[model samples]
Target: MKPQTRFNRRDFLQTATAATAAGVFIGTSSASHAQDSPNERPVFATIGLRNQGWTITDKSTKFADFAAFADVDANVLGMINEKLEKKTGKKAEGYKDYREVLDRKDIDAVMIAAPDHWHTKISVEAMLAGKDVYCEKPLTLTIDEGKLIEKIVKQTGRVFQVGTMQRTENQHRFLKAIALIREGRIGEIRKVTCGINGATGSPVIPAIDPPEGLDWDMWLGPAPKVPYRAGTEMRRGYGGGVPLHTNCHYAWRNWYETSGGQMNDWGAHHVDIATWALDASETGPNKVTPVSYSLPVEYKDGYPTVSDQYNSPTKFEIHVNMPGDIPMIITSEGDNGILFEGTKGRFFVNRGRLAGKPIEDLETNPLPEDAVEKVYGGAVSENHTANFIEGMRSREQPISDVWTHNRMLETCHLANIAIRLGRELNWDPTKREIIGDDEANSFLSRESRKGYEINM
Candidate 1:
């Protein structure tokens, strides 16, 4: 079949009622970027200032100028603003709301490292405002959001990159691994395992007042309102805080209302690479079955019965039957890495190292040293952030484009759904539906809180 080279906004709108935003967007596209002179850099704003957000922004300074910053927590916002001002030598304007930063015409791009629930909304708005986007992993909080973002990308023709940085870093370890798989070194992959580890469980903590300078209401945004409950971690860790509202920072990944537990947390990274290796970036599993799962709280129809405690599944194992009858297993039972078993050999890789018979054989049989370079489109030197900034200037799609990432994210979302439903699901990837299962189909999109409905 021919690949989808174009998208009809009207056709998409008609079929994707659940994914549509509250209203139409009529903003004009930003003017085409002028040819740049040496020493000039694209101006950008960052919408989140916590852990991953700060890390990405720090790396991004190499390619773009920090023009603005925004965060729901005013204290965090001020802290980053002060740091950037001192580090960059230019005072960056900070805002408590992301919309204020998006409204700035001078800002040509945005780095959206907000919570999963906020990623689609902020990214869509930024693109509509004529800004390129760099969003953190697990691009969408739900399947429908993936489709929504795909439509907006086509409509805007803006450069967008998902923060699956494993594709770009680590001396091209992942790139080499992918090339080896595609080169038939692993024969024909029969089975693959993605060990993304497990989720965390915590006792229900009591609620209290929010911290000073934090806009707790705005922080909750579209998610249902719950009392503030602070965490007990140290000041340096993600959950450290006096008991108040829900934990922010890295701790948010463990809640179903805000994120997708380890299924998306690490699934966004390992499952993504597995999909790329399988050459299934544009397609996915036709069957998803939940082999086992353990949630911290009871759930009914995919909604948590209790609001307190970390509600995402703490332990789970899922099996996805992909196109070509390949079995992909996602589990928390092993080390955090991907293990591929093929007819010829098997290999395992994580952030720290890549190893196995196939990799060892390469030392003797020698894949042309240029093998890894070719997998990266011959640009082995650029890190992920540099690739996005350069793509912006060249009008090319970044290494981790939204289309492929969304397809991979869809696979992750499907696994989560199967676990939540406690059954097998037959999927129609092309139609983006769950076959013969109305209940599972309903899980594709979620109802956004009023006033927070994403406007496509």
Candidate 2:
């Protein structure tokens, strides 16, 4: 068979989709990557075997074989390997350090779901180790980290996929939203509101000893070392059964040391879609202002004055001045979704629904059958993981490229910076820096702890 390189965009999509459906082997030579001949599936391994880690691996099982699993928690690492064996009847190796998974030449690709702090380190190492990567978003802890990942990706020529699945999944609702904008169903976009939920202030909990079979220090990785704290209340959903206010696991999102709280958490998803719909994926906002916000902890020189409780903002309404004079509003209040207001019409979209007068008018003045496909740039993959697999086969970037992700994520990262500094920031997007605030510019990159620094 031909290398699939000769096919044009439409033809390429058909070939890849049909070949995937038929379960045929293709892509980089078998010698180049681990491959199972009988089933013609790629070899896979997973890092950070918690909630999302297991989810992406389990979903990828349809097209790949789990060769290894790694996590800082021995309990989680061992348990996930066991679950894979039970579910797929395939025995797999488990390790505490992700380096072990990257060390294996047999693994063609690795799916990273580590906490935000560990993302860049592991991803850079994995790519340098010659592995294609499907990593969860917000892919970096700071703006500098995102730039580093982008540089490594181009330098290595490795396929990379950011897990902003809304670009591919969500029942094609997001894609349709972007398509509507492209189709002129909504005239000219005037404003966009991304209603990502706000962070919650955690109550100060006394420090406690780390959990059994957990390597506390290794888990802290690139972030500052801090005492493990847990409240009496345990969470009960998605990432449930863990302490509701710990420095790890479910509660990692609450602290700026490890993650960017709500602004970087849900903001990565919704703001990403909003950016795509506005056709501003390559360019970022000119300014990020804290219209109004409340941080749970006090700040002294942009550092948290108190350490016991959550420091990220509990409520925020940030105003971003984007290109084309569009006001992209990111609010913690309102329905958790995106509202696109344009000159011709407006529509609201989230995981559950896509509704508006424009959507209703589609009944009479229908969009083209290939609206979503055009928005996706070709035939859409059945899911985000599928898109990653297709990227691996074609040696092309996936739907959510790191470059575009970082460009839009700058707004979210800057919003956090504005709230932390208690002032609006003038940004020079071309230079990718805070225009005049030296203190705010300091937040653009973080110094990784000595031992946890990225190998790159």
Candidate 1, residues 140-176: lDDT per residue as tens digits? 9889888888878766667788999998997677888
Task: Give candidates' CA RMSD values in order.
Answer: 5.1, 5.3
What TM-score against the true fold does each predicted structure earn? 0.91, 0.92
The whole-model lDDT of each prediction reads: 0.80, 0.85
Tens-digit per-residue lDDT, 6-28, candidate 2? 12223434644565468653342
For model 2, what is the alpha-carbon lDDT of residue 130?
Answer: 76
For model 1, the superposed segments whose C-alpha errors exceed 4 Å read 1-27, 32-39, 231-247
Cα distance off (Å), candidate 1, residue 329:
0.6
